[model samples]
Target: MTMTFAKRSGLSVLALAVALTGTASTASAERNLFDILFGNRANRQRVAEPPRQQPATTPAPRVAAPKISAPSFHDYRPEAPVKVDFAAIAAALDEEDREGGAAPSPFLEALAGLAGFDLRAEKEVAAALVTHYERNPGFIWVEGAGLNDKADAVLRVLNDASAFGLLEGDYAVNVPLAASAVLDTPEERRQALIRFEMALSARALRYARDAHLGRVDPNKLSGYHDFPKKPLEAAAVLEVLARTKKPAAYLQSLHPQNTLYAALRRELKALRASAEKEIVVDTETFVRPGSSHPEFPKILQIIERDADAAFRAEHGEVLVAHAGSETYAQELVPVVKAAQDLHDLNPDGIIGRRTVGALAGESKQARIDKVLLALERLRWHPSHLGNRRVMINAASFTATYLEDDREKLSMRAVVGKPSNQTSFFHDEIEYVEFNPYWGVPRSILVNEQLPRLRRDPGYLDRAGYEVTDSRGRRVSSASVDWNRYGANIPFSVRQPPGPANALGELKIMFPNKHSIYMHDTPAKELFSRDTRAYSHGCVRLQDPRAMAAAVLGTSVDEIGREIGKGRNARRDAPQKIPVYVGYFTAWPEAGEVTYHADTYGRDDNLKKALAKVEEIRVPGS
Candidate 1:
């Protein structure tokens, strides 16, 4: 019995390798297993492989090749968005062409079946027809044999998703569309039309969502942040695409729905293009305002690349030399100050860890990874952001109040230190407490108060921290064997409202499982630094009263009057303002993009996750 062989698995294996590594090339005039395993993708050429020699005696028992799974849409696509209303889609399809050319009936009939359907492509096709008609009274996008002008337009956008780090092939645009574009039968044409529209719809929506929200999950990065996964507003995007004459321009608008995202994206692209040599961070040598380093010229070049009119006006074109050597320009004072404030630095116009990191800059790849991760974070938020909300950027260590998209108040905040970094989550600021007591977290009691208690038997008493058993009875720290408990102190610790209380005078409540809240701190001086990750896990607001005024919808004087009463009380807000504790390493505020040191190293962790995810997804030799 003769057994014939199928094509070698080597070619497909090579293809799979290319897809995974995203590089294709030709081998250097040689054939090897490494070349086969790793696609010879150096000069965008594939090396021809030699046939495998048969075994000396028994022809390796005619084995059928192992089945390699073909790539599919589900392989790379994000979570299917929550269902949306295609209610108006049929109406758009029923729409008449005031223009002499009638809308394609086959396409229209295909669309009627899609009413209340979740197929994004049908809606896209319908919207395009309506938009084209609305713009030109007698125009039709899908005409005779194959895809017309609009189909080409849709495919173009679908093809470009790769520029935004998305895979166009995953959309399967090339295969089905090409097959349909050449078919003669009307039935085949109809099927092709539907498939084409659907592919573009899925592709466009995927691109928009990935661009605006991001491709990865923030919670996956650090389990601390509870970022809600919001569905992409794909219908709205389809509408926008249909309405715009410049389809490419409309697609470009799909990135970073917010300012920080746009800023980060631009920086990422620019950094990747930047050719500045990496600087070795000299932790020992501090670059004071007047001090100069051998790398100053290169640093100045980088600054000049992004300096705007305000930055330039504030800093002269040249830095006057000082001490018979190079001096830090006085002009860059505002530059450093702005950078420090935006990055949660001391804002003292000095080069510290935060400042030095910014000055030294990151590897281009590193910044690109950061920007990509930041983009992913944008997707983790709800589909809607209230016109007025509180933004507590845990990364920047600042709380900002926005009314009608305008920044009203921005104050320094002390987030959880590196050991116990702040959690990134969102909730409503429903109420505020004046002269609030500090309900110390168990982690704090275990890691902090317990150690201090061991050192000083009366430390809790001196600090005014009250102890209570889990059963609600008062407990004396002196009675417990501190050595036995160590870090796991079983008792509760509370600091009563007073001048010495850790919670200071007020607390902002947004309840979560973590039992973390924002409150005032007696250590107000800590906010003076650019880096203020001081607390265990809770956030410390630099100015709670100011935040109170913003949240309560009251004047600062009114808050002052309420506090003057000396009554410890909680007040409910007329409307619960939304609060977001987001971690962003590179934030865009004011005018320029300000880079921050990743205090939690969340960026690095996220990069690792991305690689791990890819590895799990792609099969290997």
Candidate 2:
């Protein structure tokens, strides 16, 4: 991550890039600086390279170039012979190894052996690389005419690592390779170039593994997740790169494939634009119904960073401040919501903590951190979510049914309350329960209903709740001494299926230990509120009929007709649809984005976790 911008005294771009491999960053690609080294306008005095962004999805086929072999110099030695010190090189690598970093001394030793150890074990190894050609007069992988193109492609991928939430620092060999122009001695330079080339190969493999498999395991933390990434083999990765025509694009394709990840990347581009615009506001601070604040101009300026921003597209007026008050006095709730929508917030006109946190309306650094955290969470998802599936964002309190990456239906969703949060997990909807019974969870009884039972046993009786023993035998609530039992209520309760039942008319079932499911809610009014965390962990669907129709492969009328029968019934879904219950605070839908509340505070949890592990270390992923 090029976040460390401190000049390296005598060192230039190459050394700076080399120093960054140990850190993380949110830095953007630098085109102007890159141009001086490898752009089309680069000096042809050195090997010319073209740094261009390539489509990362499917790489175009490459036209193979003729190989250029290095000439042998074994027959006659030079007048001024260069001393090769294998021992000194080994000692230098060992010194770095003891210090504890990314120094793979064993591998470095093997690599040094191939180079004949014409190496300088000095602190200024990057600067010393310029003298590599003066020591030796041959080359390996760095001799072909196609070298410049391959080198340029790798450099472009390194600069654009932010697009995939990976750090540029992880793949920073570009600078050294590009600055190879300064190395005049062909022999030593060829040997040194191979070192950088090998380093790139090592870094690329690590980057690809991280991009494909993700860094952290969600299940390792306190969440419902079963990681599905397969182990990566170095030989397999090398084979792919060997055949890859456009190496940069091929490597780039190894990120989250869903559209949401791409959309977040698009939004990140906007963050860099409004970095200087800070607009901190209270949770209650919002665009007044009748008047707009002077800060309204500032808001417009920040929101206008994206020329095609939804707010700007909807309102193309040149908003200006008044002469005296220096404020724009007009309705701006729509604008606020538009901006919030673009950043994956709840899209409420209210400028709450979640909204401010997303808009970078606080500190620029905070905004950067928030965006970076979002990208990390994206990495924790299934590599390929089913082509046809149901996705419910617990944070957004919304559910979407999609087939072939296109949405068929979407509706407001009521997730769990703060105390009883909906977990992050995924499963297939194998069956549906119509007119379902509400077998209340024990936690709910201990924390919520037990107090009522303690106060008055008549409460359970009046609520029409049926109590039973652990053996499934029906029992009366009045039989137990409320004082005897603490928070552990060793009884089961079920509300009969009907209008008053919490299951409403339907409940979609999936296999999970959390006992969470999707179902219709009698309290439909909860979905209208800006904050919809009103359930006891299970998701309460706003329009269950539509969801049922989509999942069961039928029409809404057919689903309603079945539900209208009044009697209890169960049916298996013809084709089981996978359901993903994810927690994305910032998500992209269509060309815009939606920001939702961090209802469970999971975002904060993830941010802290990312802060600790600077890179990937998922257990057995």
Candidate 3:
């Protein structure tokens, strides 16, 4: 409890007490007040009274109370000059505590036992629980020997964890038996209450952390994954659990608040509610409009199941005609085209790989995996991706510029191949360089160029690459001993700014440790493909001038004019724009969920990692 002091007669009672009575007790009261408002002042006490150090050291492990501001007395007034007796107020507080009595509290005892509770999560979680109960020891779930309404609410939320792409068992707990049923002894009742209290706290805290910061540490999943940890204060979770009347709503609110996550949730719900059995179509080659296939009946059945009722009725004759036909007749083209359009395909009625993938629509289990993986990965990034951002979705092979959560511009982008996979991270765009020099990375230098250099020492020179020695001196490529280096090279190789340069005209630089950024590529033909994964690691933009203009806060003409006068020139962006190089197999686009092929097999990797993490979170379950 805190006491607020108001000023009287141009000085506070504390100050007046100090002035009137120069006793240590009065000074101690003032010091205690300061400590309560700010933090512990043990250092001041140690300096004032060295003999009291022994007693002060005993309370060292107790967590400090949160600092609160002192109440202001700006409008305070008194009808008449009144005297405030600080001692009387202090005595009254003490009397109130004495009246309440220091009876043994079973709840407090149970909370104390949490120090030894085996919370099977991270060490930080246990530490957080300690800090939480140390600050304010109280029960948020159980009441007496039985569960309360708040406990019921939390249990309901935990049971529905599957809807949020989480396992219910992770936060599951057996409800304590009713007082009339099994608690035949006082000790048993107390033990039941203790288990109920500690288990609720552990599960609630775990759910809070998993819903907010995600369950799996992305860094542990794979070498390609990189994400900074988001802090989850356990004390704050306890505060919410103790205060909020609507525990169910609060638990639901822990999910990622974004359009993509919401869409995925809807997709998950729809998929699970769907009663249609999955149909597996087997095909060896492209099934064109007029080409015959053994599985044409299965394909038509899939279209009929997914298409609208009106379409099904209209195409009922054709469907019956091709119910078991092995030939793909011309009459069934419209039906196949309609299904293709619905699945976001080119509507060419050509059952190519993408069309086949769409027709099959991934097994129900596979779709669920994609949605669950997407939800977990979405939690790795910020909920609000700022008003201005360039998001590159590697799975979709596209980059979109968004402002105020609305797509401002979108363009095709070529990402890294599976062997040289692009990383998943976010950074700010700092500058854009025109006629940029391509300083070859060490991976390309050693793994690619070194062998070529070993065979033809003058290869780099013929390719118009400038070579430098270890001391940054310009050297001929033929002068270096390429055989000496195996995995790494001390010398650097770079290409001067030219039309034939790999990085093309301009490169948007974020300058991260991965050396990945959005750049213009001379290989424009790669962007025309359905799946554009060809770069070593950097994102290659199809329209570099438009991206430059967007980041620089200029027009395409202005960007072109700057590029025309470019002699390896660089221009800083007016302001930093955030860029997210992300990978999502299932994502929201144009108010609908669009599922893409798991390009780097990240979905499988993440799914395996999630299973492994769950095994650790709940050993047997």
Assess candidate 3 and give its lDDT.
0.73
lDDT of 2 by residue, 356-458 (tens): 5555444555545656666767777765777999999887788999999898888889988776678777788988888888888767776667776766654
Q: What are the TM-scores, per candidate, against the unseen true structure?
A: 0.63, 0.64, 0.76
Candidate whose TM-score is highest: 3
lDDT of 1 by residue, 1-621 (tens): 001111343345445445544666534222232444443222123132222223235322322222222111112222323333334544544555333366555655455434434443323334543454333332123455455666567667767654454545534453344443466666566555554554455566556655665656565554575666665566567667656666666666665456555566677667767787665555443567777876455455545555667766665444222222345677666666765564445677766555667656666666666666666676577645678898887778888888876788888888987777778788988898988877787666665566666555445543445667678766555554454564445678776666666787788898887777888888888887767898887889888889989999998898878767766889998898998888887666656555566888777766665565444322210
Off by over 4 Å in 1: 1-145, 148-153, 162-172, 175-213, 229-293, 297-318, 322-353, 357-369, 451-458, 481-490, 612-621
Q: Which of the numbered candidates is closest to the native, going by highest lDDT?
A: 3
lDDT of 2 at 379: 73
| Cα lDDT tens digits for candidate 3, 1-621 | 223334425666576446544644875667545544553222222222111112232333322222222111122111121122223322443454467688645664443333333434455555555555545545677777678899998888888899989888888776767855567876667666766665676677778878987877776666677788776687687788889998778867777787778889999999899997678876344788777877777787777777677887888788877787877889988888788777656677777778778887677777788888889998898776688888899999888888787787888899988888888888899999998989998877876777778777766664667778678877767666565566646788888776677999899999898899999988888875767898888999999999999988889999889888858888898889888889999877767777889888887777776766666555311
Q: How accurate is candidate 1 locally (lDDT)?
A: 0.61
- Candidate 2: residue 558 lDDT (0-100): 89
Better of 1 and 2 by lDDT: 2
Decreasing lDDT order of the candidates? 3, 2, 1
Q: What is the C-alpha RMSD of each candidate to the true structure, in Å?
A: 25.3, 27.5, 28.4
State, as a TM-score between 0 and 1, how close model 2 is to the true structure: 0.64
